[model samples]
Target chain A: MPSLNHYLLVAGLLFAIGLTGVVLRRNIIVVFMCLELMLSAANLTLIAFSRFYPGANGLPDIHGQMLVFFVVTVAAAEVAVGLAIIVALYRTRQTIYTDELTTLKG
Target chain B: MPLPIFWLFTVIMLFGAAAVVLLRNPVASAMSMVASFVGLAGLFVGMNAYFAGIIQILVYAGAIMVLFIFIIMLLDLNTDKKRTPKMAPILGGLGIVIAFTIQLIGVISTTPDKAMPALDLPASAASFTPGTQIAKNLSANSLPDVHLIGQSLFTEYNLPLQILGVLLLVATIGVVTLSKKQSN
Candidate 1:
């Protein structure tokens, strides 16, 4: 049987990969992919914990699953708006490179 | 055997994730992300949360990813230029070191206690009233009886749900306002 630690290690590695992406990637869409990777990592950790610690009623405390649902919902909303913003930026600037988007610099 | 299966899925997920980051084309990256999500759903099923795993496939691989691909197609981004990271190698190396150090500390701190008793499931196999007509009615549907989830959502977390609804409404309005084209 796989232990909770194994899941945690998986989550940790995923998070690290996401962090590397966020650091190395310049495209906004790829950055969003990294963000999703990070969120999924957290979700995996939560579900593992929920499975390991059943609630008083003996049900796999559905809180973690519920939380994952909400996270997915929010991620949808975020990407919808985020992609729109990126599109608008691309329209105005003609490029999606982060370094080139320096109009906000004081 | 299960360990090998799990390891295979894990390797797939990790490889897909790396492809998502490294692929030159944005569309290919999005597709790899869908592959990763599918691999993740498989892992979830391996963990015995079949419902969540299926939902992960339906919602993530099916809906959210489609939205991503649709936007990518709609935009039809040009690959005119190659972009590189802004940070120096020294800073990037420092960040990696910090991330690995945190992971190392987390792994060390959470040592499993063999003596600590494994978590127990409730003795009553079925929490609901057993084998009644009502029970039969409840279990007949294909949907994971979300009644328990609904009850918890409405009763205990009603306020949060309401807040989330309002937030979604606001975001919808914002998107509409932002995306509308202005007449010259």
Candidate 2:
């Protein structure tokens, strides 16, 4: 049985890597991809915690998994809208680079 | 008594995440994300969150990534790959790693043993009468899996579930309005 520390560390490392990608990547789509990575890390942690703490008498406490379900649903909706927005922006601006899409900057 | 499968999936996940950062093409990065998601799902399954693991594959790797790749193709964006930036962004990325390293250390040292607030567990409420059909069904649970999720989702979280439905509907309309080619 891998200790809680192991799972937590892996999830944390994954989140850090995703964060680094988000900060450094200029391509908007890759940044969004990295964002998904971060979300996945959070989901992993939720399931991990849920598994470890099963409440009284060894019954599984599934609240964290419950939260993960909603998170996944929200993520799906968010990605759909976000990709649509990105595609529309690409149509209008001919570029998906975040630095170049500064027409609204004042 | 460690699980080899957990470590295996963790290693794969880290490798995929690194590829997501290092790959030049956005399509490649998105594919790496799918690999990472699958690895995470494997971990979830190992942890016995079976429904979550399957949903991670279906909703995340399946639907969301297809949306990403479709958008990438629609925009013809795979052709304009650029080298990863050198100085400023790298420094920024390094800063992020350092900051979250501290957080990891903190979380590893701390214990989260408190009883998280309960969310109207079926046994706690008075609404369901013991002899009533609803109460009998609600009280019955073989295991923590999809059926349990369905019961809790419809009963305890019914309002939020309805709200989520509304949110998805709104998102669909918004995407159509936002991305639809301008009507002539």
Top candidate, metric TM-score: 2
User: What RMSD, rounded to one decimal, does every model reach?
Assistant: 3.7, 4.5
Estimate, for each residue in B108-168, the C-alpha lDDT of model 1 and write its tens digit. Answer: 4678722112433323235567674434434553223255566667888788888889878
Q: Evaluate model 1 with DockQ and give the value.
A: 0.48
**In model 2, which regions exceed 4 Å deviation?**
A104-106, B81-86, B110-144
- Worst 10 contiguous positions by lDDT, candidate 1 chain A: A51-60
TM-scores for all predictions? 0.84, 0.86
Each candidate's lDDT (Cα)? 0.72, 0.81
The TM-score, computed over Cα atoms with residue i paired to residue i, of candidate 1 is 0.84
Docking class of 2: medium
Residue by residue across A1-106, what tens digits does model 2's lDDT show?
6777778888999999888888888889999988989998998888878877775534346578789999999999999898888888877888889878787899
Residues B38-153 of candidate 2 have per-residue lDDT tens digits of 89998988776789989999998899989888888888887865555578767867887898889788878896534323333455323435675545544563343675577779
Interface RMSDs of all predictions? 3.2, 4.7
The residue ranges of model 1 lying beyond 4 angstroms of the native Cα positions read B78-80, B83-94, B105-110, B113-122, B131-147
In model 2, what lDDT does residue A3 have?
Answer: 70
